[model samples]
Target: MGIDLLTIHWIYLIFILLIIVFMICKKDTSLICILGIFVLGVVGTSDFSVAVMGVFNSFVFATEELMGTILIISVITGMSNILLISGINETMIYPFTKIIRTPSLAYWIIGILMMILSWFFWPSPAVALMGAVLLPIALKVGLPRIGVAMAMNLFGHGIALASDLIIQGAPKITADAAGIPVSDVVSASIPLNIVMGVVTTITAFYFLRKDMKNGTLFEEERAVEDIEDKDCIEKNKYKFSKGTRIFFAIVIPLFFAADIVIMYIKKLQGGDATALIGGTACFVLVMISVLTYREKGLEKITSHLIEGFQFGFKIFGAVIPIAAFFYLGDAAFGQIFGEVLPANSQGIVNDIGIALAKAVPINQGVAAITLTTVGAITGLDGSGFSGISLAGSIAKLFSMALGSGIATLTALGQIAAIWVGGGTIVPWAVIPVAAICGIDAFELARRNMKPVLIGLIVTTIVGMFLI
Candidate 1:
C-alpha cells in the first residue's frame, strides 16, 4: 500500500532539493536549512511563534545527537594540541614517516589501515584515533589533508561501513527487513562493495593527483594547516624532557590499542566504542598535561580542554542548522516537534521513499534502480541507517514479485544509503572528516560527489546484471 504524502513532506522535499542545488552552486546552506526548519514548524503547528521556536529546538536536537562525536573530536584535538606544544607529536609520527615516504604510499597505507580499523571500531571512532596518528605522516609526505580525509572516508565509512562484515549492523537491518539471512546480504555485498570501493577510491585519487599536479587543490584557506605546520616546539614557552615525549608516544598508542582489544572482547559498537576512545583521549590528555607541566598542570589541563572544545564547537556550529533540518525528515520530527505527520504517513523521508517505489513497476532492472533510488532518498535524512529498512521493504516487494534477486536488491539499497549519507556526498555527514582535515565540508562533499555518483551508477548497473 502507498502512503499519502503530506504538505510537510512536500515542503521537506523541496528544501532538500534546494539544499542540493545550493550545495552544487557552492552556496552556504545554513540559512536554507534554518528556513526549512521554520517552514516545517509552521506547516506542522500553524503558529508563528512555534515556527520560530522550532528552529531553536531543532538546533538543540542536533547538538544532543552530535554531542558524543563533538566531545571525542574536542578531546582528541586537545590532546593533539598539547602534543604539538610539547613536541611529542614529532616523536609519535617518526616511525610512520619512514614507512610513508611518498604521497602514493601515504594515501594507500592510511586508507587500508583506516578500513581495517573501521571494520572493527566503526568509522567515527576509528577516524578520531587514526587521524591523530597518521595525519601528520600523510601531510609530511605531500598528501594534502583533504586527500587523507578522502582516503579515510572512502576506505572506512564508504567501504568497510557499507560492507559491515564485522559489525553486521547495516546488513542486519536490511537483511531482516528484506526477510533474508544476514549472510545472504553479506555474500551479495562482497562484489558490489569491491566495485564501489575500488571505482570510487581510484576515481577520487585520479582527481586528487590531477588537481595537485595542476596546482588547483586549495588548502591555504586555513591560517595553519595542522599541528605540523606550526613550530613543533614552542620551546621558549614550554619545556618537556625527551624521555617524557617518548614515554607518552608509546603510552598513547598502547592505551588506544588496548581500547581496540577491549572493544573486540566486549563486542562494543557505535556510541560505546566512541565513548571508550573519548575516555582514553581524556585520560591521556590529563596525564600529559599533569606530567608535562607539573605545578601548573592543574591550570594548564583546563586551558587545553577549553581550546579543544572551542575547536570542536567551531566546526560543528556551522553544521547544526543543516543537521537540524535533516533530522526533521526522520523519526526525530515527532520527538522534537510533536506528532504532526499524517495518519498514513511513514515519516517525511520514508513516505517519499515508499511513494517513489510504488510509482515504479516491478522488474529486475526497475527493481535495481528503484532500490538504489529509494535507498538514496532515505539516506537524505543523513543518518544513513534511518530509512534503509524502507529500502529493504521495497526491495522485498520487488524481488518477491520478480521471483529472484532479493539479496542483490537488498545489498544494492544498503550501498546507496551508506555511500550517500554515511559520510561521502553529504556535507554535514562528512563534517567530522572536514574538521579533521581542516577543509570546508561543502568543498569536501563536492570533491566526493562526482566520483561517488559515478561509482553508484556503475554499481547499480552491475547489480542489474546480477539480478
Candidate 2:
C-alpha cells in the first residue's frame, strides 16, 4: 500500500514549516504550536470543541512522555542545590584551582572542569559552582571575563549539555522519539560531540589569544576586591566542619564515578543509566541534607525538592506545548487525537519523509543537512533539550526513508538542537553565562557564533561521512 499524497495532512506540513519560520525569526513557537494542534485537530475531527480538547490532551501526552527527563533533571538539580548550600561544591573545585597558573591554563582548566561538573550536575548549576569559585581567579590571573564565559559556555553548555552523555537526558528524549535505544544515540554522538567540542573550543581559544595579544581583550573593571572579599565571607558562612566538606566532596565524585563504572560494566545504557544517576542524586541530596540540617532536614528537603521542580518545570513549560504539536507527527497522534489514525499511518513527519523520499533525490548528505536544520529550528525556543523529541522523530522519519543510520542522524540532530539552544549561540539561552560573566548576552552569542557554526558545519560534514 502506497502513501497517497492526497490523503496526507498537508496542513501538518504547513504548520511545521511555519514553526521553522517562526524559529528563524527568533520568536517563541509555543502559541504557534498550540495553534497547529488546533488546526490539525479541527482538520481531523471537524469539531471545534473536540479540537480544543485535543489541545489539552496533547499537553498531557507530552508531559507523560517527558516526565522521566523532567524528574531526573529535578532530582539532580536538587542534589546540586544541596551541594551548593552545604559548601561541598566549593570543596569539589578547590583542588582544580591549584592547576590554573596562567591565563591560558585558566581558560582550558576552567572549561574542562566545567565540562566534567556539568556532565554530572548540569551546566546551569555547574556554572554557579565554578563561576563563584573560579571566575575571580580567572579574572585575577588575566583571563578576560568574555574568555571565561566563552570557555564555560562552550564546554559546559555547548559540549557537555549538547552531548549529555552521563545523565543521558538529551539522548533519552531523542532515542524515545526515534524509537531506538539510548545507547545508540550516545554511541553515535561521541564522535560528533568530540568534533564539535574540539573544533569550537580550539578555534575560540585561538581567537581569544589573538584578541588578548592585540590588546582588544581588556578586563572589565568591576569591584574584584569586594567580590573576592564577599565570596570569601560567603564561603566562611557555609563552612561545614572541614571533615564533612571533605567527606562529601570525595564521596560525591566517587558515587558518580562508580555509577559511570557500573554503567559501563553492567551495560546499563539509556534509562538505566539515567535511573542510576537520578537515584544516586536523590540519595546524595537526602544524605547531605540530613547531615547538614539534621533537625530541619525533612523541611529543608521539601524546600529543595520544590526548588528543583520549579527549575525543571520552568524549562519544561515552554517545551511541553511545542512537544505536543510535534508528538502529533508520531504514533502518539492517535492517542492525542482520541481517534484511531489510519492503519499503517506513518504520522506527519514520517509521511513527509516518505513523500520527500519518493519525490526528491535525497542522500546521506541531504538527510544530514535537513535534520540539522530541523533540529536548529526546533532549538530556537531556547531550551536546548526541549526540541530534541522533534529531532528524534524527524531522524526516525529520515532514517526510514533512507534505510540506515538512524542513530547517527538522531545524534546529528541532537547536536544541532543543543548547540544552538543549549545556551551557546542563542542570545536568550546564553543569558546565564553572560549575566554571570557581566558581559552582554548578545555579545557572548556573537563571540560564540563563528566557532559553534564552524563546529556544526565540520561536525555535520563528518557525520555525513559516518552515516
Candidate 3:
C-alpha cells in the first residue's frame, strides 16, 4: 500500500511552479491555470478530447465550490449599497467623527472604526463608508489624506480581512482546502491576527507621527487641490426621515452581531455561518429598499441586486480559474473529471509536499516560512482571497509531514496573503481605499509596505512559538 513517490505526477509540480513564477512576474495566472488543467486532463485521461472538455468542467467545478462565497459577498454588497443610497451608511459612522478632534486621535479612531466596519460589511464597502464620512474630518483635524488612506487600507483590508472573524469568508476557503473544520482555522487565526494587527498598526502610526513631526507628511499637491474645494457631504440628498437612517444604522449592526452570537452558541461554523450572514444581508436589503423607496423600492432593489452580482462575479472571474488548477491537486479532481484517482493516490500538491519533506528535511520553522512565502507570492495577482486555497492545501501537506499545527500554519499563510494582496501592499488592490480618499494607490501601498513587512516577520516568529 506504499505510495510511489518516484511515480508521482510531475505535471502537477510543473504547473504549480509555473504559477508561482507567473505571479512573481506580476502576470495573470488564469490562462496559465487553464493550460495546467488541459495538460493535467490529457495526462489523467490519456485522451486529448477529454482534456479539452476538462477545461470547461474544471471551471464549472471551481464555480460550484465557490458559489456560497460568491453569493454571500454579493448579498452583503447589495445590503451595503442600499444602505449608502438610503444614507444609513453615513449615519452609522457620523457620531464617531465627533471624537476625532486631533491628528493623533484621528489616526486611531479612523483605523479602529474602519476595522470594525470592515469585519461586518467587508473591506471594500467599509472603505467607501468610512472614507466619505471620516476622510474630511481627518483632513480637517490636520491628518493628511495619505494618512487617511493608510489607516483605511491597513486596518480595513489588512487587519480586518486578515482575521475575517465576523463573515468567515476567508477562513471558510482556507479551512475547506485544508480538509479541516472552519472553527480550527478561525480559532488558530485569532492570536496571529492580533499580533499582526497590533504590530502593523502601531508601527504604521509611529512612522506617520515621525513624518508629521519632521514635516515630511505633506500631501501630494495635485491630490490636495482636487479635494480642497470638495467636502464629504452626501451629494444625493434624500427626503427619507432621519428616523429611517437611525433605525437601519442601529439595526444592521445589531442584526449581524446577533448572527455572530447565534453562530457561537449553536456551533454553526462553516457553511452555516456563511448562510446566516448571507441570509441576514438579504433580509436587510429588502427592509432597507422597501422602507426607503416604498413602491419605487421594488425597482431599486433589482438594481442593487444586479450591481452586487456584478461586483461579486468580477472578483470571482479572476479567482475561479486559479482555483481550478489548485482543485486538480486535491480530491476534487476525482469529482471534477469523473474519474476516481488511484486508491493510494496522493494529490499533486500533497505529493510535492511529501517529496519536499523527504528531500529537504523541513522543520516547523522551515515549514512556516515556506507557507508564508508561498502565500505572499500567490498574492502578487492582487486578489488576496484567490490564492488562499493553495496556502491551505500546502499547509495541510506540511502538517501531515510534520505531524502538528495545521491551523497555525494555515493561519500564518492566510495573514500573509491578506495583508500583502488584500489591499495594504498591493497597488492595484489598494484602489478602493486610495480612490475613496483621493490619494495615489501606489503611494498608499508604499506607505504600508514597511509596517506590513515587519508585522509579517513578527507574526511568522510568533507562529513558530505557537506551533
RMSD of each: 7.5, 2.5, 2.9
Q: List residue ranges in candidate 3 displaced over 4 A.
A: 1-8, 219-239
Model 1: colliding residue pairs = none
The total number of steric clashes, by the backbone 3 Å criterion, in model 2 comes to 0
Write candidate 1's Cα lDDT for 335-381 as tens digits: 77787776666666556656655675566778888788877765665
| Top-scoring candidate (lDDT) | 2
Looking at model 3, the pairs that clash are: none
For model 2, give the 10-residue run with minimal summed lDDT: 221-230
lDDT of 2 by residue, 1-467 (tens): 33333333677778767877887888888888899999888777767998899999999988998888899899999988878878898899999888887789999999999999999888998887777888888887889999999999999999999889888889888887887888999999999999989999999999999999999888553424322322365346555887889888998899999999998899897778889999999999998888777788898888888989999999888788878887888777788765545666667677777777788777999989988888888787788877788788879878877888899999999999999999998899999888777789999999999998899899999999888
Q: In candidate 1, which residue ranges exceed 4 Å CA deviation?
A: 1-5, 99-228, 231-239, 342-344, 362-467
Score residue 4 of candidate 2 by CA lDDT. 35
Computed on alpha carbons, the lDDT of every model, listed in order, comes to 0.76, 0.85, 0.83
TM-score of each candidate? 0.64, 0.94, 0.94
Per residue, candidate 3 scores C-alpha lDDT tens digits across 109-147 of 999999998887888888777876778778878899888
After the best TM-score superposition of candidate 3, give how far the Cα of residue 113 lies from its true spot, in angstroms.
0.8
